[model samples]
Target: MEHVRDSFARQKAMTLIGASLASLEAGASEIRLPYRADLTQQKGFVHGGIIGMIADSACGYAAYSLMPASASLVTVEYKINILAPARGSLVARGKVLKSGRTLTVARAEVYADDGTHVASMQQTLMMLPDTPDTPE
Candidate 1:
């Protein structure tokens, strides 16, 4: 759990929420991201793409924390569903559905701070072997 705390604390984007999601571990995370002007659409709601990115990042990190230190993972596929328009602030909750040697499956839910479920996503990640370091 110390590694999870330290790792998220050092993460730039995830740290935007301060401690909201910083204490997240293997089970679930409640992440927050304020809606800045850059994150809004013409209708003054958070953009779909931004929501997708948040969901993807949450799931990826959740999977990464469960892997061995020498392994890494990348998204193989993702499916997102926009449930409602997102406004003001956003909160994404991520959970690991399954973790295996070569693959991980996760789900995330994006909600407006007002408690509206804005989107949901499921992501599949492909675990990769760590690259060996060579003497320079």
Candidate 2:
């Protein structure tokens, strides 16, 4: 998963939000983000958009983990459900449900620092198997 690690490291969005690649394995991946005031919505909880961002990336990377080294991916669509007010640090666990040649399905569940399920996301990712990643 070195490529996965490298790709994630180069993601400016993740870096901007202070997210880190916590773990990565075939068909599964995890991302972690520490709580920050700038990430909060008006109600003093993490913003829904930020939660979706991490969830999408988590699922996208999970699908990418199962693809060929040269493959590039894009999330065609994703549906996210925010279940609770997120506080403290967050962990998003992503798992691949199905891996196809050109389309993949994956899910990501976000948990609060206390382990409460705060959000869930499922995404459809399109893979370009012959496309290579951009240089860092």
Candidate 3:
């Protein structure tokens, strides 16, 4: 947990966007972001790209939390579906569906603070071989 929190704290983009790590566990994590006009689309809803970014990061970190200390992860691909306008503070919850030696699969769902589902994401991440410099 210390490592996970430390790793998350180092992500500058999360700080820049006012995103925070809300929770963390062995195979799960959540991030929250407040709604800011600067982060919205022309229609005043949170942009889909921001939603995707948090989703990806949340999922990636979830996978990372379960990885061995020497391993590192990189997202190989992901797909996201925006289902509703994100008009309020948002929370993205990510969970590992499968952890493999070479590949990992995770899912994330973003929801408006009001309980509206905003987006869903599925990600495939590659687990790189361990290296001495790996942070965790």
Candidate 4:
């Protein structure tokens, strides 16, 4: 949706790192983040923490896309598995599994440009009441 795309465009980190929204439909979103020297760890591989952050952001945005404009969400818990060392570019795809009035559960997968499965993550997001100034 245009709103989602606009919101993503305004995200400084996503913009600065060149993360792009490849696709979005229903309650899912696919994002791509190219690996640059800045994304590398001291050993020259993509940092594990960066991988987790991508997964988290992907899932969070996917979940947010399904909610009513008045509802806001935040990650309450996340579990991630690093299957292999990440190098080069990465793609993250997220999908919403379930959504309730108070919680949403989502899953995401991170893959290397070579199509290797690098990591996977699942997160639980809590819906919070929004004040007038921060309405969703």
Candidate 5:
């Protein structure tokens, strides 16, 4: 949907990491990240933190897709497991596990260019209805 695409496009963090929204549907989304030397570790594989970042956003977007138009969301907590060394490009697929009025649970799996499973994540997100500006 336009709303989802627009929100993803406005995410500066995704742009900083050279990631793109590959596809999205209600309750599901995918992110593609190109491999870059700056994102790798000494082992020449993508760092776990970078992997976690994309997985987190991937799940977050999935949860957001199902939220009401007037609501915005934030990650409450997430657990990610790195399964293999990530090389080349990566694609992360996320799907909502449960959608609630106030909380949503989502999961994601990252795969390497050759389709090697690289990481998995489960996340909890809190949906907040838009409100007037509040003190930060």
Candidate 6:
């Protein structure tokens, strides 16, 4: 839990978006973001890129939470589908669909505060090999 929290604290984009971890568990995680005008597109709705960012991090963190203490994780691939206009506060929840030694697959869903599904994501993450000089 400490590692997960610390890792998230280091994300500059997350900090800029005012996102925070809503929950963290062995193979699941949730991120929350309050609506901010700066995050919106010309349509006055939250931008799709912001939706993807939170969804990507949510899935990445879910995989990271399950990785060994000495390991770090990186997103290798992810696909997101934007379903509806994102309004108000948002929450993205990620769950690991599969875990392997070198690869992990996860799914995530972004929802508006009132529980409207705004976007969905499927992600693949790779475990990074540590170099002798590097630390997790």
Best by lDDT: 2
**lDDT winner between candidates 2 and 3:** 2
- Model 2 misplaced regions, further than 4 Å: none
How well is each residue in 10-125 modelled by candidate 4, as lDDT tens digits?
A: 66767777788888887899999998889889998899988888888789789878866555678999999999989899999999999888899999999999999999999999
Off by over 4 Å in 5: 131-136
Candidate 2 local lDDT, residue 115: 85
Residues 1-136 of candidate 5: C-alpha lDDT, one tens digit per residue: 5667777888888999899999899999999999999999998999899899899989988988887666678899999999999999999999999998899999999999998999999999998888311223
Q: Write candidate 2's Cα lDDT for 32-134 as tens digits.
A: 9999999999999999999999999999999989987788899999999999999989999999999987899999999999989999999999998778766
| TM-score of each candidate structure, all chains considered together | 0.81, 0.97, 0.94, 0.89, 0.93, 0.94
Error of 2 at 131 (Å): 1.0
- Candidate 4: which pairs clash? none
lDDT string for model 3 (5-57, tens) is 77788887899899999999999999999989999999999999899999999
Model 1 weakest 10-residue run by lDDT: 127-136
lDDT of 5 at 41: 95
2 against 5, candidate with superior lDDT: 2
Which pairs clash in model 6? none
- Assess candidate 2 and give its lDDT: 0.93
Top of the candidates by TM-score:
2
Candidate numbers, best TM-score first, in rank order = 2, 6, 3, 5, 4, 1
Per-prediction tally of clashes? 0, 0, 1, 0, 0, 0
The segments of candidate 4 whose C-alpha lies over 4 angstroms from its true place after superposition are 129-136
